[model samples]
Target: MLGVTDYGAFVIAFLLLLAIPGPGNFALITATGKGGIKGGLAATCGVILGDQVLMWLAVAGVATLLAAYPAAFHVVQWAGAAYLAWLGLRMLLSKPGGAPRTTRMDSGQYLRQTMMITLLNPKAIMFYMAFFPLFVDPVHHQGMITFAFMAVTVAALTLLYGLVAVLLTHHLAERMRASPKMANLLERLAGACLVGFGIKLAAMR
Candidate 1:
């Protein structure tokens, strides 16, 4: 059985990490702004799929294997960290919301970006790798049972956060579109948050 403290810590850490706007969050917001609630929700589903893949991979010992090989693990971690840093920089530099452009978001783009964003995120991989071991008492519960619990918890959280972001973007789309200054500020804040998270992940033992 998982300890209450472990579960609480996992929830807090996961939610805090997700709260920081990154490529995934920005993508969701942009989709909401462009296509309203329905479109945003659809894109969010793609994100959920990407997360689900990672969750399973973690439970399968992929993260453990990567952790075992120091050189290879460092290579993967650095690459992921660099990718996240690049995303943060890009978000910081991007122009604010503008008039709805003719460029329509397609399913392909949605899936591709969602997968890339989640998979490329070293911080996220590290998080699950670190988090799952805490609550999992494989001696007490089956490995699959623990993994299933964690996966379901994460999926539900994703849905909640995605919907919250979608609603916020939808509610303020027009105002956000008009305020370049606010957009730039949000971009900077989000970028800083990602960079900070990356640093924290990199520093972890």
Candidate 2:
């Protein structure tokens, strides 16, 4: 487990997190619908790479530095809170059914677009910076090795989730169209969760 406590819970938590509706999910669904399996797969690759980048940057920097200057950790917490709250508000205000935005036939285009979105994704970094530490056994932490293991675990989980999402989205494309309300409800719920997380993170201090 590489210093990760409750490894099973970590995996389960991540898998459940993936189940939540979000921009990345929409991008995958849209890519599949517009460009088929190839495009969806390409987008999936993009998401994995983007998440890897975000994960390393946060894990190596924030987690490392924060342990030293614990006070400075508040900055990250505040930033995450503001960012999450903003995103939640935006999602709440957005006309449900709206996605992060996409539609491309070229695999490369889908990859690049999704990668960029994931790179700038608020939820990605917020979760990494704020949520990751919860499971870290600081006393048993193995520095980079621990972070690396977590990163790999995250990447592998994302790949599995993306593959399943692509296949399911492709298969459910028609039914999804028929049940647009379900998508809207998910968005609303996600927005609520984001806001709740933001408040909770802010209060943790």
Candidate 3:
């Protein structure tokens, strides 16, 4: 319906994309670990908002512009990579038993920070531009309706994923709170992953 072909396939593809480890996931988990459910939900909202913006930009042909301008794409890619790497390094160097700086931020700050992270990644824009078209039939396209449906679908799935992540991370955080050493180790691990993702993004063509 809504001029979307293979709706089931779209859901599956979106879910798979969400499951991939990335800066967004790292931010969600870290926020939950520090600020509990409230922080996690705030970050979730930020991600959803950012994704909607990117998806619509794709629909508006921003992706094509980026493709035509390699320099612009590279600039965004490098900025995203640098941001991730910097955050990771800060976390890695944080004193043991200290909470991640992200956790220290209030809810509004958390939302904005996550939104920025979500918006910075050029890969996400590319994914939306490529992925959305696969399920959109140009001949039967309902224009805004089709785009709206896809946007709603993405938001719903992302909320579900974020809810689950928040719950799980919060649970772990509670347990870790009892053991400072364990919490520190987990934070360090998350930091290392973010660093690795940053490096990978920077190296992407």
Candidate topping TM-score = 3
Worst 10 residues of 1 by lDDT: 94-103
Stretches of candidate 2 above 4 Å error? 62-104, 174-205
Counted clashes in each candidate structure: 0, 0, 0
If scored against the real structure, what TM-score would every candidate get?
0.68, 0.65, 0.95
RMSD of every candidate to native, in Å, equals 4.4, 6.3, 1.2
If both were scored by TM-score, which would come out higher, candidate 1 or candidate 2?
A: 1
lDDT of 2 by residue, 66-135 (tens): 5577566676666666666765666567565565333325899888757865665444565698878888
**Model 2: lDDT to the true structure:** 0.73
Task: Give the clashing pairs for model 3.
Answer: none
Sort every candidate by lDDT, greatest first.
3, 2, 1
* TM-score-sorted candidate list, best first: 3, 1, 2
Per-model CA lDDT versus the true structure: 0.69, 0.73, 0.89
Candidate 2 residue 36 C-alpha distance from true site, Å? 1.0
Q: List the lowest-lDDT window of 10 residues for candidate 2.
A: 96-105
